[model samples]
Target: METSQTHENSIKLTSTEDGIHLDGSILWLDSKHTGDISFLSNPQSATSKLDSRVIATEETIRILESFRKKPKALICQYNRPFAIGPLNMELLPSGVGLGGASLWVETNNKKILYAPQLQPQNSETCHHMQVRKADILILSAKTPYNADANISRKREKERLIETIKKMVSANERPQIFCEPYATGPEITKILSEEGINVAVHPNLFRILKVYEAYGSHVGSYIQHSIHRGDYDTLLKPIPQNKQLRRVFPKNPVISIEDNQGPRLDDGLFRKIDERFYIPSSCDGRELKTIVPKIKPREIYIFGPYAKDYVRQLRSLAPVVKALFPRHLPSLF
Candidate 1:
C-alpha cells in the first residue's frame, strides 16, 4: 500500500488489496478485511458483504431487508454517534437513494467523512445529504462529466411531469422504467404529488412501501394489475425480459428512464411510442458547488469520472485524489 500525506495534517491514506485504509485502521467502501470495520454508505454498498461488521443506518438495514435477508450489522440512526471500540461514528443521510447514508468518523482528534454517494439537494423520497467539515473527504464522482451533469433535480422533475402529462393527453399510458430502489420511489412520489395517478409494478411497490414506512411521502399508488386500467402512468423496474410488453400489449406505451436507457430484452424496445431521460444524481457542477461547503483539507473521489472530477475539484481542496474503486458495482 502506498501512503500519501499533506503538510498541514499527518493523515495517511493507504490503498491496500482489500480497500483504501485511513491511518491503517479504518477502511472505506470495501469490507473484505476482517481487521477493519466496514462503513457501508448505502444498502447497495452492503449487498456483496453482509457478514461483515457494517455500520449503517436503521433505514438502510430496513431497505436491505425489503429485498434480501437481514444482514449482520450494527444498526445506527442519522446524526446519532455510536462507538465501535475506540472510534466514534455517525451515519448521515447521503440523499442518493432510499436509506443511503454517509459515514462520519472521529478518531484521534481528527474527523473523517465518507460520502461516496451524495445528492446534497432535497429529494422527494430520501433525506437531503448532510455534510460536515472533515480532515479527509471521500466523495463520489458518479455523475459523468457532461452537459447532463448540470441539470437540476427540480428541472428534471418538471420535465418528467410535462412528459407524463403530454403522454396522458395523447391518450398514451406512460410506462416508465427505472431502478426499483433509486429513482422509482422518487418518481412515484413526484407524480403522486402532481395528482397523477400511478400504478407501480410489484417489485417497485415493495420498495415504495419501505420508503413510506421511513416517513417518505410517496403518496398514493396502486399495484399494477392487468384488470385495472385506472392509472394515468405505470411505473415498472427495468425489464429483464419481454414481460413488460406482454402485460401492457394494447396500451400505447411511452418509455421513460434515466440517462441510461432501460436495459430491455431484445426486440422489446420497439413497442414504446417515446422515451425520455430523467437524471437521478447530481451533476459535476453541483458537486463543485457542494464540496466547497464541506471544507475538507484533502479530498478523495471514487466513481465513473473520478479523474476528471479530481481536475475539476482540485481548486476546492488543498489535495484532491481520484481514488477510483477497483470494482465498480451497480448502485441498485
Candidate 2:
C-alpha cells in the first residue's frame, strides 16, 4: 500500500484555468480548442424544483448567452480517441442521456477517467465498467446520504415498471417526470414498450428530435418529429411509419406538454397527476464497484456526501473530496 507521500498532492483551484490537475499541480483544461476539453453536465440536476421556481437572472442569461455565442462541439463518436492537450481523450457513451459521454483520458503513461456521472446500469456495452488501470478516477456522488448504486438498472427499471403497472391497473394516469436534457428519452422508451403512452415535455421532445434526425439509438424507439414548431404545429399529424397516439383528446394528437412554468407537470393534463419521477443522478456506490477494477492510485470525489461517508471511503483508495469552488482548476 502507498502512503500519503506517494499519493499525488491535493488539487489546487485557480481562476485562470478551469479545474484540472496536471503534474500533481492544479492547472486549467482549455476548451478554446479540442485538446484537453470535453463536456459533462454539472452534478446538480438541470431541472429541479428550485430551478423551476426561479427565472434566469440577467447574469444567468448572459452566461447562457455566452455559451451560445461560442459553443464547442463535443464529439461523441464512441471509442474513438482524440487529442486533448496532454491527454488522448476517448469519448465513451454513458447510457444516462441521449449522447452523454464518459471521458477516458490517457497521457504520459497514465490513464485518468473523468466521469462525474458515469452510469452503466442499462448499457450492454458497459463501457464505464470496462474502465481499467486508471491512475486517477473522478466520480460524482449523491451526498449527505450515500447513493444506493448497488441497485442494478434492471432492478430500477423493474421497480418502475411494477409501480406504473399498478397505477395503471388502479386506473391512475401516472405522469413520469423526467429530466428534459438527459434521461427523458430513456424513460420514454421503457414506458412506450409497455404500451404506456408518454406525454413528453417540449424541451425533451426537441432534444429527442435532434437525436432522431441524426439517427441516434436513443431516438430509435422515441417517435417524434425533428421539425421545429410550436406545440400545436408539432402535434399536427405528419406522415411516418410509426403513427403517433394521443394521450388525451383535449391534449391533441401526438403527446407533448406545452412550454409553461415548471410546475413539475407543466403541460400535462390534470388527470395525469400521479408522478413517477426518474432520478438519473449518479450514485455513490458506482465508485465502490469501480475502484476494485481500475485500482487507481488516487480518487477524487465530486458532489455532496457526509463527512462520515467520505471518511469511510478512505479504505477504497487515496481519496479526496473535489470542492468545486475551492479547487477550481485541476488538470491531470
Candidate 3:
C-alpha cells in the first residue's frame, strides 16, 4: 500500500489504500493534498415546505474544484485519468448519455435540477418536467459555456430545451434559473404568468464577470425560427435548391439570441457525421469553422439577419425539438 496526505497544500500521494493511517487525516482521502473548488446548493431549508428536496452533497466539492482548475473542454466520462489521491473521488456526471438522469438531489419544495452544464435550457420535455412546480434550478454554468460540439453538452442542447428560463418546473419554487447572471425579462415574464417565482443567479461569481462584459443576458434566443417551423424568410439566401429557398417565412430576427444579444454564428445548425459546423467569420471575413476550427469547404455565407448557416440547414432539413423523458409520478 502507498501513502497520501494534505500538509502544506503541495499535495503528496501513493497507490496502496493500506499501510496508511485511517484516522482523522485519511478517512475519505483517496488522494494526497488534492483539493477542489466547489460549492453545494443549500439543503432543503427547514422553513420551506416540500415533500422531497435535493441538496448537493460531497460531490459538490469535487465538481467545483474540477471547474476551478478551468478544465479545457467538458467531457462526459466517468473514468478519466485525473489523479484523485486516495479519496476515490469520482467526477460528477456530466449527464450526457446517461439520458435524462440529473446529478442533483431535489425536494418537493423545489424542482431542483443540478444541471452539470450551464448552457441554454431548451429541452421541451425537460422543461415540461417542471410541471411539478420548481422553486430553484441550480445549473452548472461552466459546463458548456465554452463548449465544443460532438460532445455531451452538444447533445444536451438537442435533448433538453436550450431555453434556460424554462428549465425548472413552471409550478415549483418560483423557478430560479441559476447561472452566472440574470434571466431575460421575456423568460421571467413567462414564469410570472404561471405564478412561479423565477430568477437567474450566477452559478459562480467568476461567471458574473463574463455576463457583465456581455449583456445581462448570457444566453442567446429561445425561439429558434428554424426549429419553430418558420423557414421561409430564413432560407432566401441559400445557394442550394431554389425550391428550398421559397419554404421559409422571412424573419427579421434569425432567432431570439441573435435578436436580443450576441451569439455564435446563426449559421451553425447542421450536425453532419460526428461534427457540428457553422459559418464563422474571422475578422469580418466570415468562414465556416468546424465548431472551433472552420473547414475550408464550408461556405461562410451569412443568411437573413446575418444567419446563412442555420437558414441553409433549415432550408434543406427540418430540425426538431428534443423530447426529455418525463419524471415518473412519485411513490408518495
Candidate 4:
C-alpha cells in the first residue's frame, strides 16, 4: 500500500478498487461507485443541481448490489457503521438534505473525518452533533469561493423574506424554480407559515409528500403543482378552508418547479428585483467556524474550491489540497 505520513499518527489515504483503503481495511463512503455514465441518461432531468453541477441518482446508486459486509451498527441514529478489517468505518449523515453520508474512519486508535460534500443548516440540531475531534479531516473544495461562509441560516431566511416582500410590494407574483434535491425545505417551511402561497412541481411534490407522511409539518403546506395557476391532476388531499384559500390571493405566490428551461449563468437563482429566491446548500463557509471546534490534526480539501480560499482553515490545523481523479476510488 502506498503511504505518506506527514504528521505524527497520520496516514495518507488512498483509493482502492473496492473502497477507500485506510489502515488494513477498506471503507466505502457512498452507496455505490460503479462509475457508470450511461446510467445518467438525460443528465439534467435525472440529477439534483448544486450550482452548475448535477448529481444523477442512477450514477449515485451505481448498482443494487449488497455490501460485502453489512453495517454492524448505526451512528447518530441516521448514519451506518461497519467493521471492516482492522478499521471501524462510520458513515455520518449529511445535513445538506434528506439522505447523504460523510465518512469517519478509525484505525490503530487514530480517527479520520472525510466530509466530501457537507452543508448543514445552522438551525439543525444534528449540525453540532456531527462535529468531533479527529486526527485528519477531509473537506470538499467546491464551495462558492466568493460568498461569505459565515452567513447564518437565520440571516439567509430573513434576506429571502425581505426580497419577497419587496417584490410583492411591486405588484408581481414570483415564480421560483427549485432544484428537487440540492435545496433543503427550511426556507419553504418558513414561507408556508407566513401564509404565502407555495406550489411545487409535481415530481418534487411527490418527494415532499413522503416527508409529510413521515410527519413533516412543512410538507402539509407545499402544493402539488408547478404554480398556483397551473393545472394539476392530483386531488388536494385536505379540504381547503376559506382562510387557506385567501393566503394565495392576499400574498405573492411562490412556486417550486423542476428545471423548466436551461439554467443561465447563475442558474435558477435570486435575480435583482426578481420575485424569487433559489436556495442552494452548496456553500461551505460555515466550516470556517465549525472546523476549528473539531480541531483535526491535519486536513485535506477536495472539491472545486480553490486551495487559497481554504487556506484560511490552516489556522485550525495543517491543511492540504488533495484533488483526486473522478474515477479514483480513494483520496489517500
List TM-score per model, in order.
0.83, 0.60, 0.18, 0.62
- Could you give candidate 3's per-residue lDDT for residues 1-332 as a string of tens digits? 23332223222222231111222323211112223222122111111222221123322222333235322222322322232233222233322111122232222222222232221233211111111112222221111212233434334333323233233333211111111112233333333344433333223333323323433332221222333532111111111121212222221222222111133222333211111111111111111111122111111111122232333222221221111112211111
Count: clashes, candidate 4:
7
- Sort the candidates on lDDT, descending order: 1, 4, 2, 3
lDDT of predicted model 1:
0.70
Number of clashes in model 1?
0
Say which prediction, candidate 1 or candidate 3, comes out ahead on lDDT: 1
Residue-level lDDT tens digits of model 2 in 50-127? 111111112222222233332333433667666745657665655544445556777667777765555555532112
TM-score (C-alpha, index-matched) for candidate 1: 0.83
> Which candidate comes out best when scored by lDDT?
1
The candidate that achieves the highest TM-score relative to the unseen native structure: 1
Question: How would you encode candidate 4's per-residue C-alpha lDDT over 1-332 as one tens digit per residue?
Answer: 22222455567554332223343333433313323111111112223321212122221222111112222222223344656467666655545444344557678888888665555553231232365578888765544443444544466567766666566567656544344443434445666666565665455565555444434455234455444563211222111121123223333334321112222222232222222333333344557767776688787665445364456566777655444444532312
For candidate 1, the per-residue lDDT at 212 reads 82
**RMSD versus native structure for model 4:** 10.1
Q: What's the lDDT for residue 199 in model 1?
A: 99
lDDT to native, each model:
0.70, 0.44, 0.23, 0.44
Greater lDDT among 3 and 4 belongs to 4
